[model samples]
Structures are given as structure tokens and as C-alpha cells.
Target: MTGYDQILAEVCATGRRLTRAELESRRLLGERAAETGVGLRVLVRQHLAATRTIWPTLGSVDADRVLAAVEQSIDAFAEGHERAQKLAVRREEAARREFIDDLLYGRSDLGRLAERAVRFGLLLTRAHAVAVCQGGTPLDDTDPATRQVESALVARFSERRVLLATKGGLLICIAPADQEEILAHFAKLAHAATDGGRVAVGRAHPGPGGIVHSYEEALHTLDLAERLALDGPVLHAVDLLVYPVLTRDRQAMADLVRNTLGPLESARGGPQPLIDTLTVYFDSGCVAAESARRLKLSVRALTYRLERVHTLTGVNPADPTHRFTLQTAVIGARLLGWPQTEL
Candidate 1:
């Protein structure tokens, strides 16, 4: 209100509206106030007080003229204040986006990243777990569904150190390793808000690099779920650790798939139907009735498929000793996307 006092007094005495230059000066003052963290309401109150103080001294001016001048000046000031605030918000958002990208990808200097992490409510020194949601529709920061989850998370866990963001078209939440409930609630909210989606939680690891590891694990869990056609909507990387181990040696897994299930390709419909039978059979825990029910097949037809598998593969899927080999091969096939992927 440095220039505001003089301008208001002059307008009251002269009974004239502010000139364009005077209004522009007021706009600049408002921008400065906004940048310096002064509340607009507070500034407006000060202007009103100044107007009242100058009112009696500036004798017999046009009351309507002074009021109009005051209104025009305040509007210009508010417009400038809002413009400055909007710019600040955009800058903050850009910085946050950059920080998250660097933090998750481990692309920046660790010390720098750790320092930046503090600004975003993260302690890079502590262990963190990442949970990712992959749904039918891709989610981003601007999505209402994503914002709802973020708001819910912040409301319930405001004191906790957590960050929710979007990466690779998926919603990602990073939380302290010890705060499993945070990830769990994030998954719950994500499922509800997104209509339906798979949420994958990665095992917690220590330090900044740990976040990268956990993020990768979460992403891999989602990928594995898609590749394996897993039924569960929520997947934990720790529980699915065997998948990474199984796929560690890609060629070996491919060979196992090709060797164990290769013979079934000679059947009338290629290997897919037989592979499906084996998958359902193994998934059903050798329960022929359940497998038949799941596959919508008669018991006899299911048995015939089993027998056909035994005849072609030379191993009885029902035999306990052979079950291990067949089941392991079936899992490898699914992981490698055997028939569809030329494995």
C-alpha cells in the first residue's frame, strides 16, 4: 500500500477515476504483495482503512466518483494478484513433477535428490515401498480419480511422508516401508475410484536407490500380472518373487516351455487349448471337477484333455511325481507367453 495511500487520497480530493498508469501501478503492487505472501483480503482492508482516513480531509468530492475509482483500482489489483498466484502454482507443479521423475528414476545426483525429496514430504534415507495401479484407463495427475485418491491419502495420512504421482500412464504411491497401511489404503481407494484396477506393491528397500528398486518391482508386478493372466486384483512383489527368479534365465524358461509342452502342438487345435487345460488343472490343484467347471467342460471332456496331454507329453499331469515338472513347465510357459510369443 505504499503508492496506494497517495493514489487514494488524490482520487478522493480530485473526484477523478484513476488513470491507466495509476491502475497499472496498483496492479504491480498487488503482484508484489502476492509474491511476498501478503493476503489479498488484508491488503483490501488496508485500502479501505486508508480511504476512510482520507475521506473527511478531502472535503466535498463526488462520493460516487471516489467509489468508482476505488472499485476499478481494487479489481485491477485482484486481477494481478490472481495472475501472480497462478504463475507461482504452475512453477511449483513443474518443480514437483521434475523432482518426482528424478526421484523415481534415480536419474539425478543422490544428494540433490535427497534434498529435493524433503520438499515433497519424502525422507530418502528411510526405506520406502511403491504401489502402482494399472487400470483399464490410464491415470494421470489431472484425472479426477487420481486426485480423489491423492486427497483421501493426504487426508488420512497427512502426517506421514508419502507421495502420489503418475508415471508411464499408471498411478503410483510411494510410502514409508513401515507404513504398510498406507499402501493398502492406497490400493483400496484406487480400486474404488478407478472402477477396477490391479494394484501391485513392491517390497520395501532401504535408501534412495531402494525407491527405484521398489518402483521397478511394482511395475514388474503389474506386467507379470498381465503376462500371466493372474486373477487377483492386488499383487505383492514379495509373494510373486518366484516369478522374477523363474524368468531370470529367459532362455532356460523358454526351453523348459518348449520341451515340456511342445508335443501338445500336434493336437487338433494347437497347444493353446491343452495349455489352458494344464493351466486350469494345475490352478485347480488337480481337482478335475473344479477344472472342468472353470473350463465349462464335461468331466469326460476334461479327463480326455488330461489323457491327451499325458499321451503327447509322456507325463501324467495327475501323478504327484510328474505334477511338479508339468506345473513348473506350465508356469514357465505362461510367464514366457510360450505359444503366443514363439517361446
Candidate 2:
């Protein structure tokens, strides 16, 4: 028989809902029937009833029996449309997730990226940056912050072009490059939502390959921001570029803190007085008077603290060479969480 007859036979034989074959047949037959000004539903009803009317006329079969057989099949087809629509929706969603996951994880093939890109209505070749929002834990598709970020970005930018995914307890977004304002905008929203958590934005990079680069940048940004305790609702990689290097060698960092500031930290009154004095002294550009004023201490007391620092560490913050070593040590100490966490 025709394509339509085969679809109907299969549905009747298996008692199945509308299959893909049936849906395709409906599309074609519906288009043909529309030429005669008949809607799909009305045409389908007429076609189903034809077996009854035509069989009686040809004196080959009972009208009632044929109508009953085909009419039972109508309900199944009706349910099939909804199932078909849902299936289509689910398939599209799955594909979009795959496209995003593969892109973020750098598993997407460059050759096939163009084809997959078009399927999602996105151009993978555009300049892009990845932003990661580390809010509360157990974050996923249902998280409110994630939902809000997705809604805000897509509302402003468009779903086809942006890839937003929440995995491994973080929300990662890949969007157009130079959208610094957009990244900052969402950062504030997440900040307010989490009562001030961390939001890391990476430097913009070029093309599809750039997505992974940007993702790496964002990850490093977040890591450094946490290590350095960098402030602000939105943290950019550019702001703390030097921090990553400082954090790279944990053993070296501990050694630096131990060798440089370790002596002062062990002073009679604990490290705060010396540490605070050193920090303010460094902040004041090695000016005795200004450092004393900032610390609300007399110049004599500040001098004494500086002398004590030199006495213990054997490096004066005033001597250019000694100051560089001491300053570097102070910074390394902070980054290594020294004193707070035992050298």
C-alpha cells in the first residue's frame, strides 16, 4: 500500500502511538489535503472514515466494521502528536547539552563543530570567553542562581549563541568576547544571591578553540581569587595575574614565608604586631612617620618594631634589596595563609 496505509497498519498491529513514520505521513498528507482547503485534523478524520463509506458502496465489507476498526486507530494517532512534540523537544535539549559539554570540555572536533554549531544556531568561530560562578553547593539545572543566570544572559544575548551549563558544583557560561559588562552584571546578581560568593570571569579569546582557553582562564582566576582572598563581587583574571605564579609552588611558598616572615611570626607577642606593622610600613612606602600614623603608633614605637623586624629577619624594610625580599615575603606569607595556618 501507500506510506500512509503502512503507518496505519503498523499502529493497528502493534497498538502503538503515532510513530515517526506516521508523523512524516501526516505532514505530507496534511500538506496535500491543505491544497484542497482541508485542515489536517478534518482530512485525517475523513480519510479514516473513507474505508467505511467506500467499502459499503463496493459491496465488499460492512460499513460499521471498517469504521470501528479505523476509528479506534484515530485516538492513538492523536496521542502521537503530543508524544512526537515532546520527543522532539527532548532530543533538541539533549543535543544542545552535548554541544555545550563537548565545547566546554574541549572534546568537540573542529571539523564537526561547524555542523553542530548550526544545529544550535550558534557560531563556534566567534570570539568568546568563559565565566564560572561558584555559588552554593549542589548546583544544577534547578538551582535558582543558575536559572537566573541563564534567563538573564539568554534574555540579553540569546540562547543560540551562549552556552550555559552547571556541572561539578559550578555554573559555567560561554558567550561572546568583550562582554565584560555582561559578565560583571551576572556576577553582581550571583553575589547578591549567594550573599557574596565568588564569580570568576576570564580574558576573552578567539574562535572555537578559545572557549577551552577561556574556561581554563576562568578556572585559574577562581583558584587565585580564593587563594589570595581577592575582594569584589566580580573578579577578573587580569586583576590578579601575578597571583597564579605565586601560588604554583606550594612548597616554595611555604619556604618563603617560613624563611622571611617566619622569625617575626614567632616573636614574643605573636605575629600580629610585627605583621601589622610590616604591612602598614610597606603600604606607607617605607615612610616611618606615615606608617606610624596609619597604625596609630608613635614613630619611636614604629622604629622599634622595624628594628625588631630587622633584628629577627635580618632584613630591613628600608634597604632596597632587603625591602624587596621582605615585601615579597610578606606577600608570600599572605598567599600561603601563613600564621593563620602554621607556616
Top TM-score: which candidate number? Answer: 1
Distance (Å) between predicted and true CA of 146, model 2?
2.0
**RMSD (CA, Å), each prediction:** 1.7, 7.4
> Per-residue lDDT tens digits of candidate 1, residues 1-343?
6777678778777777789999888889889989999989997898788878877876787888778877888888998898899999999999999998898889999999999999999999999999999878988889999999999998999999999999888999999999999999999999888888889999999999999999999999998999888888799999999989988999988888888899988999999999999999988989999999999999999999999999999989999999998898999988888788886
Question: Number of clashing pairs, model 1?
Answer: 0
Report the CA-based lDDT of candidate 2 relative to the real structure.
0.71
Stretches of model 1 off by over 4 angstroms after superposition: 9-17
lDDT against the true structure, per candidate, is 0.90, 0.71
- Residues 215-334 of candidate 2 have per-residue lDDT tens digits of 888888887677555667677877777777876897887888888887775689987679778878887898999999989999999999889988998998879978877887787877
lDDT over C-alpha atoms for residue 77 of model 2: 41
Q: Give the number of colliding residue pairs in candidate 2.
A: 0
Worst 10 residues of 1 by lDDT: 1-10
